[model samples]
Target: METQELHRGRLIDHIQLVVRDLDASRAFYTAVFDVLGVPMGGTADDYFWADELFVSTADSEAAEGKLTGRHHLAFQAQDRAAVEAFHKAALANGGTDNGAPGERPYHPGYYAAFVLDPDGNNIEAVYHGEAKRSAPSVKVAF
Candidate 1:
């Protein structure tokens, strides 16, 4: 018997996050989503909507005194303007700027911005296009 191949589309369904504090996670994600114009859904301690992905947070089980590196997550933006808006909103909502919106030679036409969430998670909003001569100026904290 031949096995059937499953064909799936390229959209993300959801993402799960194990956070120390559910309420804080909710607030961070809610603010981030609002900035990106993404609707937040689900009740506390279980689910929330971020972009097209549903994110959930649970208790962390790591040992004490050990540091866990930052977790990275990226969201797709409608355009360069949206990415810039998201970066601005994230800074206003207590997120730290990791990187500003700009072009990267690593990926062709990659314009993106990075932010560190309240829980130290790395979040990014990206748009794929050719590098523009004039891009929005974003303030960075030293």
Candidate 2:
């Protein structure tokens, strides 16, 4: 079977998090992203990526010789159910709960769930209730 690689040309392009344990981070992300509907795009001895997010070991060049500090990253969810599912999968895969699934104070219609990845980075899944957009996201190829 063949799988398509996700695009990599957003305003942020890509974000990489260098981790202490690549394997543990890998397992944690795999479980959470699965519920969010993103697949593991590719992997190497020291790194792996899914969509625009990349995870690598401290030795990877992308780390620039430093492990990243705690960061808060939020992934968009299609609905409240997906957000709930992401939290469950994360908890089952070595993640610690930061916040349970619920409506947040961020705004009305902002429902989110947060977890701490193995490295203590905040991972979140959020659904903005309902919205209409001209397109799903920016698409570019090179």
Candidate 3:
């Protein structure tokens, strides 16, 4: 089995997204994460993961029941270029364009791109301009 780690520093330790098709979700996420520079953690018969995100099919024990419904999830990108790469990658990997990459009214310098995954999840990549962080993240191995 491939070992992986998750960063722990926020209110939510982790989030599991139950997908209808693990293979499709995996391909979609694999492409997107590659642009974001996040490594694919591991995979099982019914699930696969990347960084802090866990994606499993409804048949997986972790899901317990049904697949997840439409949801909006925005991942932070290092820069606007990364956001553009994310959109291009997602589209090349079975994702539909929800919104083109551009600055939004959400806030100044909030350049972002949006796409719909195989399961219709509204996934986004946003670069909040330049900023300083104390730490990239709190590493937590599992």
Candidate 4:
């Protein structure tokens, strides 16, 4: 097998969103991820990625020309300002506002923003108050 390394969040290893319009999705995600401080992992004619989220055209080999159903994916933000910035950047790049930046009842300091991506997937950026992290993410190699 080919050697590889990955950085992952606590629960999910990665998520692949197969979209009808790869370009539109890429644009939307690029802007949002930029504001969240997540760099694009890599890209190709039909796909792109940032952190653990992979986006692709249905025509991409792995997608087998099948689009995935709408999904709710949330990203962690460093602070409330990042969440607000994520909303603005997403809107300017083909995203629709689902919920503007604000605190939610989910918990104290559960500030977040939600947007519908090019394919209507519910995307969120959240900042759960100030907290410390032992590590940014878990790393795996093979």
CA-lDDT, candidates in order: 0.64, 0.77, 0.78, 0.78
Q: How far is 113's C-alpha from truth in model 4 (Å)? A: 0.3
lDDT of 3 by residue, 1-142 (tens): 7669887544432456877778889999999999999999765888787766888877776554543345547788888998999999999999998789999875689898878899977677888788787887788787
If both were scored by TM-score, which would come out higher, candidate 1 or candidate 4? Answer: 4
Residue pairs of candidate 3 with colliding backbone atoms: none
List pairs with backbone clashes in candidate 4: none
Model 4 misplacement above 4 A: 1-69
Cα displacement (Å) at residue 135, model 1: 28
Ranking by lDDT: 4, 3, 2, 1
* Tens-place lDDT digits, model 2, residues 113-136: 878899977677888788786676
What clash count goes with each model?
1, 0, 0, 0
Better of 1 and 2 by TM-score: 2
Please write out the lDDT profile of model 4 over residues 1-142, one tens digit for every residue: 6759989765433466877788888889888988989899665898788877878777776443543346657778888998999999999999988889999875789898878899977678888897778998889987
Candidate closest to the true structure, highest TM-score:
4
Reference-based lDDT, residue 53, model 1: 56
Error of 1 at 16 (Å): 13
Where model 2 places Cα greater than 4 Å from the true spot, the runs are 1-69
lDDT of 3 at 96: 90
